[model samples]
Target: MPSENQGFSVWGFIKGFGKLLIGFLLLLQGIIGLVVMLLIVGVIVSVSDNLAGGKAARVDVPKGAALLLNPQGVLVEQAEEVDPFEKALEEAYGVDEPDQVEARDIIRAIRKAKTDERVAGLVLDLGGLYAPASSASKLHDIAAAIEDFKTSEKPVIAVGDYYSQEQYLIASRADEILMHGFGNVVLYGYGSYEAYIKSLLEKLKVTSHIFRVGTFKSAVEPFMRDDMSPEAKEANLAYLSVLWREYAASVEKARALPQGSVQRYADEMPPLLEQANGDFAKLAQRYGLVDDLKSRPQQLAYLKEKFGADKDGKSFKHVALSRYLKAVGEAEPDGEAPNIALVTAAGVIVDGEAPAGVAAGGDTIAKLLKKAHDDENVKAVVFRVDSPGGSAFASEIIRERLLELKEAGKPVVVSMGSLAASGGYWISSPADEIWAAPTTITGSIGIFGLLTTFENTAAEIGVYVDGVGTSRLSPLIATGVGPLPEVAAELIQQSVEEGYERFLRVVSEGRGLERDYIDSIGQGRVWIGETAQGLKLVDKLGDLDAAVAAAAERAGLEEYDVVEMVEKLTPFQRIFGGAAARAMKLAGLDFAEARAHQSALRKLFAQIKGEIELLDSFNDPSGLYARCLSCELR
Candidate 1:
């Protein structure tokens, strides 16, 4: 074993040194962490005061600078709650997730920039924009604002390397759209696709027990079958077609093309591209979808010619949307003005508390409503819902709070976002008025329960779970490890049926419709906004602003300020957390693992993993869900 030929054992020396260094670093990290915690507690109060009065951190607007409309994140009704320390750590290691930009923030910026003398023009740098098919309403809202901005007689130019379907929707509103010479403009209409895991579960010797009501309630189909059921397909296609029609119509109207031009462009792409000798840019121009094609440098030169140059003369004089918002600051309400509290109930409905932009925790939303109920200044509430639904129990919890708010004599208006189905509809039922966009997906009024057991898999590995108990429900105790008993399964099915009846009753009472009629139209069917209005599911077809105005009108407030009600952070969390994270990074405590950028294959796998993870996150106490899995648009 002795290496006589290996004179210095260089490899062994390096290995030994690496181990020693790692051990030392681990020891040092623990000591440093302890000290940092103590130091944070000591500086909490002073840091809070400084942060409260800090004007140095604010960004300033340059005189006559163009407001660069460059949003770099997913457009959300409300941003998720982020821990500053965790965010800093992610940034320190360069693995932070994309930022969440609020739709309201973008609208506010556009509205403010419309009249601001310092803002001379608008630039659409939307190469990083990623709006989902479900966000058609929000996209239209932003595009409408851009149209309104044009009335101020300031130039609006959209320059990008390429434009995605959603990105092009906003770019179409600009006075000029410049794309890269080699860029392509493709438009893929709406679709709903999901992984079917029934065969995979069978191969793994796993059993999936699904309980559901409604012929169109296909949320559990991925476990029950390898393909979408006819009813599910019919319902999904109906809504998807509506959304696509709306999308094509909007783009056509904005670009001033014929009514069916956008549809023809998408439909005739192959032959059109062949005619253009495979030049996507030329084909786009030929079809009148874009203005001109230029490279990045040429685009920059063109912008500089329009808006003049910056002090350095490298590019145009403009302030990014993020920085521009910072300079403008948030608008505060006038003293004693009646307030219309806008509360966003986004994400899946879940029990207890949850971070913003995550699951819509029943308790968290209820707490927000409770605050609105307690505040005399808040005359009405505009509840924005963008969810595909989740836990039935959690939905009821939120619905009860809305009822309380209504009982308190405050008008509650529900503004449906991209999707407000199943449990999303449940919470909306209690509102005095429900507003939805023409493309909004809603009315999945159904309930389902699922339980996957590993009994067969355990048996395959020579393991078994068996026990004796006091009653027939004894086998249910080990349901995860043993076979589910017939008696227990029957009881669970009965519970699901009861839940469906309760959902029907809730809708009937909320909408002032007969229970029989509600169930006739219900049966877990999904409907688009326009169709839903005809079906009496929604009162009006409109956007969030319309809903806000309706809430004000109901409250009889001639002059009122719209206020976004959000969670407040503690003094310590707001200041010390970020500081501590930065300090730790500087101290060489680099514990974050480096994640490589995702490839196409990796993204596919991630989608599959997300579906499984979503199933795992179902934590309803009743084991019942009012979710619409088929509601997602592609």
Candidate 2:
């Protein structure tokens, strides 16, 4: 039935068959390569994770086990609480989750280990502890707990390849501090820096309209100016000096290295290195900053001799931080409980609710406070505040809610974290007692508002517009409006001054300081926790738990539960957010891997980009803001 031409085309038929065969072979090979790559990625990641975590559930601590206190990754107020399945998937796939250890968890673990008979001492492995200077003092409490152990002569050994300034604070408390032969003891004293975008804005012909009350309010500097203002420089220097002094004093006392050893070492690090022929290990020993220089195995040998080796004699028996936490369990208060509510106002103060990383939004925190207030079993509220400050109205809203808690007969105690400046200080004004760490950065009592218009930018691109309005200040603000209308600028400026006055009054009444005195120390000035306490901006120097204890005492409760008033992740976000992208990236299929990473980065950047969308955002239907832009220190 074939046509005559089709029957005669034998060579053409052979060529078609060969091409089909080649296409099929290529498709098969690609499928095989993909499967193999996936299998390899899975096997490697699964084995590593399973080996690390598969046995964690059943891990048992043997007798005389020392707690290995090595904190890796980021330390935050609270970690995102994930379900078991999500957590397992994350660990297995090596998904990027910022390693977070709660201060309470650390304290509780140390306290439990101190009491547990099987626990002998602590190994201060804080090499990976990335924390801000304000948090340095918070960790001091854990070191204090170790001191309790030291009274019993339990040897606390500190070991690390290198010690950052923050890590050295905790390390200084150890009985014996060891470093690697090549490791350096670095102490670049704390200083803050900012990026000026004014020139760029000018280049793009975008105009910024700024309103601020305090001379020391440097938040608007980046937009309007290139460098730090003289007043800002003076204020920043004063607080940074105070913080440095505190740091030096602590290290000097703990190391018994004389009055000014820490300062001297900092001032003459180059000379000291030269003297030791650039041998940092030698310099550390010569300066008494460290007791010895040893490699990992050598340090292991030292521990083995002191604590007695494990059954295999490979190393000393020790309980990891995670293992010890599980073995000893979280600190549950004794007796019938559920009385104290510990609410955290950690993160940048926003106008509305946000997830874990972003911290307290005004609405979210208000709801949380109300939630605590409504609970009949909740007797006292401990507000643990750590913020660089955001919305002025939002901070006031939070403070008003705290006032409500007081009106409802519930005592509200405030514990300041690393940063509680501007709006941070505003919200804490009404607290029954405000406790801050010696290293806590607080008190940037100021108000500022920023707006941008791009009329000039549009003009540069050959666009022009003229508009008519019913009122002189109609559409007071807009993206294409050049040099914000005079009437609108005056209004914003007036609001900022009033907001500042209100802030002054709040601090004046709540802190029991004179209006003039508060003003003298305020004007957007930051203070070290120690200096703040001296200035009467803080009641006492203590940790979050201490604040909780004060709250419990004020409520007259001998035995109470400390419930966390923190954000809870949604079910969908928990199951599919972090773990799914993590799984695909770990699979190494190269399928949208870049996109997967972009998703994670987007989560972090999206929050920041959305932050400055509108000056009205700071105005928030209220007026200007009391945000502390300089409160954050990198």
- Shift in Å, residue 82, candidate 1: 4.1
**Per-residue lDDT over 1-634 for candidate 2, one digit per residue giving the tens place of the 0 to 100 score:** 4776787688689999999999999978866775575456556655665566533345577799788998776666665464555456555545555566776677777778777788888888898778866565566666677777777767789999989888888889899999999998888787878788889999999988888877788989999888888888888888888778888888888899899888888888999899999898899888999999999899899888877888898878898888777776545556367579988887778787666554568988898999999999899999988887888878878888998999999999999887788888898988999999887889999888877888898888887657677987865644345447788888888988898999999999887889999999888888888889988999999888789999999999987888877666534334444444544544555434334435758666545654654332453556467777676665
Would you estimate the TM-scores of all the predictions? Answer: 0.91, 0.82
CA shift of 145, model 2, Å: 2.7
Displacement of the residue 622 alpha carbon in candidate 2, Å: 4.6
Error of 1 at 212 (Å): 0.4
Error of 1 at 444 (Å): 0.3
Model 2 backbone overlap count: 0
- Candidate models: Cα lDDT each: 0.87, 0.79
For each predicted model, how many residue pairs clash, with residues at least 3 apart or on different chains? 1, 0
Worst 10 residues of 2 by lDDT: 589-598
Q: On a 0 to 100 scale, what is the lDDT of residue 172 in model 1?
A: 93
